[model samples]
Target chain A: MHKTALFLAAALLACAAHAAAPKPAKPARSAADVLKDSPTSDWRALDPDNTLLMDLAAGQVIIELAPRFAPAHAANIRALAHGGYWDGLAIVRVQDNFVTQWGDPDGDDAAKARPLPAGASPKLPAEFSVPIERIGKSAGFTKLPDVDGWAPRAGFAQGFPVAADPRTGQAWLAHCYGMVGAGRSDAVDSSNGTELYVVIGHAPRGLDLNITVVGRVLKGMELLSALPRGTGAMGFYDKPEQRVGIQHVRLLADVPVAERPALQVLKTDSTTWQQLLDARRFRGGWYVHSPAHVDICSAGVPTRPAP
Target chain B: MHKTALFLAAALLACAAHAAAPKPAKPARSAADVLKDSPTSDWRALDPDNTLLMDLAAGQVIIELAPRFAPAHAANIRALAHGGYWDGLAIVRVQDNFVTQWGDPDGDDAAKARPLPAGASPKLPAEFSVPIERIGKSAGFTKLPDVDGWAPRAGFAQGFPVAADPRTGQAWLAHCYGMVGAGRSDAVDSSNGTELYVVIGHAPRGLDLNITVVGRVLKGMELLSALPRGTGAMGFYDKPEQRVGIQHVRLLADVPVAERPALQVLKTDSTTWQQLLDARRFRGGWYVHSPAHVDICSAGVPTRPAP
Candidate 1:
């Protein structure tokens, strides 16, 4: 019995010594590892109904529409897209450090204005916000801790940056660079989705919950963001010849399968995503110090090929 | 006595009536009024020594150097400019939504490298930050109240977005879109102002206090920002044929006075500036609702002829 007790004591001491000694640090993981380790359920396919493919001279830009917040605007946009309303329209506005707008340049004149194609709505209720309850239960939202002077609560929902107000039970999209919104005139409900603009500079959150944001340009932002600044007020092209003509805008499903570009977006709700965010938030090696927090707009959503 | 008391009572009643009656709202002032109202002391002309003019195919891009933050780098840059180092160089790097870089395309090869002319330094210290106390009063700072994720306090000083830490008493230029900085390799101090880059996307504040920000592109940003993205890594031109050759970069003083472009920047410290900020922060007419606060970056600095 004495020998057995002594043996147990010795084992305990050995275990304690091992715990005190430093162990080899775990190997650093690449961004790819974090995404791969994410659960399969976190991955979501792009909804064909909410996707827009803007074909440009260089390539195509994929836009993911947000109908949950801007239902009226999104519906009108869908009608316009289906009717091929913007098939040959030109990008008529390119404001430096502001926005790149596209529509019927002659829409202001009554006689020369292009009529809204059949099935397309000429008007839409400013669908800027919707009740928070209407947002899907599995939408995946992580609130940002920092204070945003523009919104009551700012964070990420699914893969997009969002703002919410519990008091009003309302939620809407926050205006970040690359975000797409419908252009309007003096009237609040003037937008019909035929005219659109994309934020290209600082996040114009003032436009948040004010205009109808339909979607975000996922890829090929350069094709639009790099256009020459217009000399006219609000970045409108003064000369009729200054506008860059659009060939066509078609849905990916409507296009031939061989022409469709294979693209994949990193799932925002996955643990891999959390790791990626953490990595961005906390810099290692050359970075002398790590930022304890990160703004939702600064956390970039990675894009690449699907396995 | 009775007459005096009656007169006093009547005057009091008139004052009370005036206070009770709602005063007519003031007329909306233009951005020009905002600058005109500013104290002359607040307005300072651009220093010819610290300014650079890059003549492009479209027009000239004026850049104001921040020597206080990057003295060593700025000095080297000034020397390079005076020596006409970039007279025959080329814009060889353009990364979409990232940066547009310009430098000697053959810089990497020791045998083919261009030699630094007289008064130019081959080596320079990484002048990323300086004492904050020297800013504003001495360095011409105009602070803005906003939450900056990268620094304790952030504001504009001498037409530049700046980040400062009161605790450490250090300040550096913030990396905003169109902001120009010297590029370097793995060595933190490798840059000698020969290679330079401009931020072309979302403000990479992560790079603040980590690099030498020389200046900002005051004009003709479209010429650089609109260039096609290079197919090589870090946006380097894969072939010599892909590079866009530089015409010349010179100080406005060096050019003939008749050739100088008439330009003026809005005085940031003026009352008109505050009014403009307020107008943008809380848009009244067209907007039904307005954001009470505005990010420092979102503020627009108008440039026009000095009327």
Candidate 2:
């Protein structure tokens, strides 16, 4: 059977309708096919120590912390999770075409605010971007072919979407869909990892280098993205009941090995990753016009269930 | 009082936490502030004949068709609405990070399919892009300052996101968030505007010239963006019951005058729109490192309820 249009269901059904039509010219391999042909070495399992499991009523959201990019924020998040700081908090905001934020709803009130857990600092140096040297010589940065408006260069840095400045010699995580950040106040050092927001819409590249991006959601983004939009200002829920409760958050390392999610991400440095990018950049299957360019965010890193 | 952190809800509450603190340094105006100061003439009311209201259990989605871009598809959609072709159909697909698609769930089955309503075509010459001359000299094309990798140039044509290639003398509607498109099969001219989908997540620019983008949803995007993801292939619901029922679809012109939504979109050619773009490109409040560029999609055309 002819391959389905990757983006549209109607196209899939329409292709089915032409069952008697002669086979069209052989289509080029798709990104899915490239992944299928990848070697096992091309995929890497999530590091439990740097992984976060956010449990909600709907399902678990797996986040891979990019400590290399924002070590302070990542460490703060670990401390908060270890202390069970976010066990009973709720997702208080779901802004359409923007972000879904979760933290303490009463955090604004001094009298009602929850105290920070042990080892978590209220004020820390903002890790908006790390020095190029910090990532080390073997950071595995796969540069994109196209230019990005937000940064001098954009590509994948160790499996995470990244933007870099050659002149400044600094690199930061790009705010692509599912990329998570530490929410801060007017002061650059105000964030303590208590408040977190994930990019759920278009790549808000403007946010790049302005906030401490600590990680990206690897799985179960649907749980956060599909939540009802909050009705109040900045998409804050009008009532407490409207907030979706976060049952608990745990470092995957803290969870039993058997309970940990079996997730694997394609290595950005692998040949298979390049093949996948090429497949997307060049037209195949149902694609008519070959968009020879692929934005770094659009060429998303592939993740899958472990075999 | 200070402007809240535009992207992070925690920043809003954090500002509240510092109520008694000394006033922070003066911050620059935000996009919201720019819109607040915009002149009444900078806004244009939606043309009733070109506007579509899709009623669902959640709420209504308002789409403004761009007849200047895809005349045939727009006319076919108008006819479909006139005959109530989509009155009882269900939204069959909700692909995370992609689109929310709706049409006849039985469209693929010849025996079960409902015939196209009177005057609606089953095939259409793909209006993927048009000669630049078609838009006329007064088309109000406001080019973006940043270069887009997907096209030679990207900007706002009138109030809609658009991409143009001056070398080819062609321009097309861009695949921005909330932009709606006609779904097609392997054949280039397979779509007839019956199966429509809306971009609900990141801007899938790769789909720009590959599909017929008929219009864009101006309001109530949360209604479509927050729908549950379909479990079946291509984000199609596995079971029919899981699909969200469409109460009805109607042209704003066909509705009673009092029943029509009083909506207005920011004119792209206005000085206020340019100021808004600059405000986003040159960050001030709560920003440490200013990203001096903004993608065309990020520089979204604003819309709001009429005064």
Candidate 3:
């Protein structure tokens, strides 16, 4: 097994997958392997209207909104972005293995906080969850073979990781890495989509059906995920200077045509996705044991530059 | 939820469980709640000999070695730390959603790398997986009731997160956030414990049994996880100045007794631990549905300031 002496080579997060332990004399074909052979039809382009171009000092992060799941929040977020709501705001909290929150730091103080722009609202109906039946055709759910402890079924839906209860015909977004959600108070209906957070580490699945999952970061996650964690409790920066200022959060539609993120995500219902799932379910090669199972968060859906 | 319009307050990752949404009108009481009632006997102090106090400019990170799983690798790591082999080294790679690597940046080049100290061996047999039967009484295995897709069983051994294959009677470390592993080439035995990395985001379980996992970072993970991600391919810094300098990696035994980390980890096999597990499996209040199941990675054993 000591074939290569490239110390830094194996340290990379390889996208390739394996077959099973005591592997055959050939390389095991996994996710990376399957993806390379996927048909072009399996990949879909991002919709500019439903996309966000979050420009920070480090780089740009692209997010895709889920209008079908949380219509009011989605509309408000789009309106806020259209009104240049987050231009001067700063990322205020980065709880390790949890989330990175951003908004007006003085949002709590009525006198000091930045007032909501014309299109933005102070409150909206809690879209924490919705009936699966209402999700309709755009829902696009593909349940995992393995059962989840959190939901009756777990899988990808409408291009977002989601958990569903077949018994109640209910469904909503699941909080996997890069998934975005609205920040709210103890009251379930408190969030107005002004403040938002991105899941930066573990998938706090418990957050499912408890908050408004607005969108997901499709690219440039490191810009937010790798920022210095807040020293203050729950990962809040102790000082104002530590927070990274948000340069602009323009909706893709508002940005110049050439400046938009030219990206595409693999469709969850495509044949390539099924191949990726199979490869993950039976990894071999360097693996001593084939998990024969894959976790909802661990099986990351691949994203790439549009060809 | 709009009890107060504290923007930053609601944005921070709050652990206070919700208690509404058709819930049982009572506190679900998970680890955050049961931890308050844990007995002193349920927690164990960190043994100086098995601990590595990694001093960085940001702060100190303490790692507890898993000697039971990889004895040779552990011994080599201890020897390297005791000899100050890693002092002045720099963290060279920070792959978001993957790992943070630290070691001799010139490790791959035989001409420029730091030589291993006297007691450290350059070549050690791979300890990727071992027969469970050989595990001594010190290796405590507590299997979770929920099923896993990765291994036959998921549990903790010697307080380290682990996966086991009962058929082959083998067990090894399960990759989780904070797990520390030696960086290697493609070779199975390329690592000598000098180049190491810690999981900073999602658990790359595919690396399990493919590399040598030595220990786990018990504290100061944010110091590594939150570092600026390198723009270079594979998250390596293109410029030498981008790396974070390491001060010293002194073994606990080498440090002055007065300066040791006064900390203890909650025992995994204790009744208190079981209660915490039950709480996670059946969380109710504020929860729309209790996921009677929990992932092995999500069931992180707690570590806290020793009373």
Candidate 4:
């Protein structure tokens, strides 16, 4: 009986010892890992109709339009693309830590400015925002779990970074890095999609709800961001020769099928996205302290080549 | 008596009419206007001993060191400058939407590595944060009005963006655009200030409290940020020819007095700075919606050539 008791105590001790031993920590899943493990259903292919393919001397810059937020501007942009309005135009302004603007260099000179295309409107009503109800909770709006200083609520809707105010019942595209907007005069309704600018520096959130944000760059932002900054006021190039010439600008639908970019954007509402957020929030390995927070602009939308 | 009474009634009516008339609205002051009106006392000249002047083929890039934050690292950097350690070295990495790193290309290869200067320490402890008491309210700590996700509290201290945790009693320099940091390996204390990088894109706040930030770029950021992004992994240039060569690096004090850069930085504690903040917060004219909040990084430390 004593021997049996000793054996039982020894077994219990062994169990306790095993339990006390520290197990090796599992490797933290990175955003890349989450993307690799994501199902095919979690990624959506770009609709050619809603895409713009702009070619510069450096490289191609692909942009995805956000018609739900700025329908009129998007439509006008499509018409302008079809009209090849920006084919030979130039990136006239590149303000360091601000934006890169591309349009007709003589846009301010009415006599020298190019005429608007038949389908493109000469003037557009400010499409700064739509009704909040249009992007209801039922929609694929993955809200960020953090406070934004500029917006009431911030999130991603249909692959675009957006801000919404339930109290005002308004939703608008945010001015995150790579966000494209229409440049306008002092008048609210002056912009007509002729002058477009891309945010290449920090997200100019103050511009949110103030300008007509039409789309965001899906790929090749480096081509635009790395351009030499203009020395003129507001970063306008002093000499016409300094402006970066555009090779071509076309709607992706107009491109040959074989030349179309095979790209996929991760769905923000997927489970893998949630894992990505957690991974960003609690960064492991080499990181001594993780703030348990991610800025709306910093939590970039992930993209990959289509399989 | 009737004529007198009629005159009195007329006077009263005139007074009432004057009171009812609306006052003309005052024109909003712009940031440029504020600077124009600023007193010389509101601007400070750069301290020659605390400045680094590096010449590339493009132009001169100036850096202002933060010795209070990382004294040992700063001392090591001063030694390096005296030894001309970075002379003829190359800018080897430029990650798009990230940093521009520079150092000896063969730093990792023991046989080909450049030797550290006589006074520069080969190994140093991580100087990520100092005691919060070091940067107390008594110091020139100007707290920002908006909330930041990365730090418990964020503000400017002596023209440098800084984050502090009162509870943890720690304060560290923030990783804002243009901010410079010492690049280390996986180990926290691995850096001896030989390799350095500058933030060239959006503020990577995730790096806060993780790496030792040493200084900030005072001028010529466009030269660094506009470099072609390296095509290799982590943005390292795959070929030696792709690396941008550094012509010379020297302490401003070491240079001839006439050759020193004459520059001034706006004092954050001045009344002009408050006006500048208000001007930025309440954008007028072209703006339709003014977001009252400004991110710490977006509220750039204004610098200009000395008049």
TM-score against truth, every candidate = 0.87, 0.91, 0.88, 0.90
DockQ of each: 0.21, 0.36, 0.38, 0.26
Scored on chain A only, each candidate's TM-score is: 0.85, 0.90, 0.89, 0.89
Question: Per-residue alpha-carbon lDDT of model 1 for B1-307, expressed as tens digits?
Answer: 0000000011111112112212214435444455555555545565677788887666677887778778888788888888888988999988766788998988988999888889999888877788888676766576665455556666677677787777777888887877899987656687899999998776766666666788887767777877777888777789888888887888666767777766766566555565666555444455665555555566656565544
Name the docking class for model 4. Answer: acceptable
Off by over 4 Å in 1: A1-28, A32-41, A134-136, A256-259, A285-289, B1-42
Best by DockQ: 3
lDDT of 4 by residue, B215-288 (tens): 99999999999999999988889999999999988988899999988899988877777667656555666676
**Against the true structure, candidate 4 has what lDDT?**
0.80
Which residue pairs collide in model 1, if any? B34-B272, B136-B141
Give the CAPRI rating of model 2: acceptable
Residue B144, model 3: lDDT of 69
Instruction: Give residue B220's error in model 2 in angstroms.
Output: 0.7
Alpha-carbon local distance difference test for all models = 0.69, 0.81, 0.77, 0.80
Question: What is the Cα-based lDDT of residue A205 in candidate 1?
Answer: 75
Worst 10 residues of 4 chain A by lDDT: A1-10
- lDDT for position B258 in model 4: 92
Ranking by DockQ: 3, 2, 4, 1
Of 1 and 4, which scores higher on lDDT? 4
Q: Which stretches of candidate 3 lie over 4 Å from their true place?
A: A1-33, A134-138, A282-289, B1-33, B134-138, B284-289
- Model 3 chain A lDDT-worst window of ten: A5-14
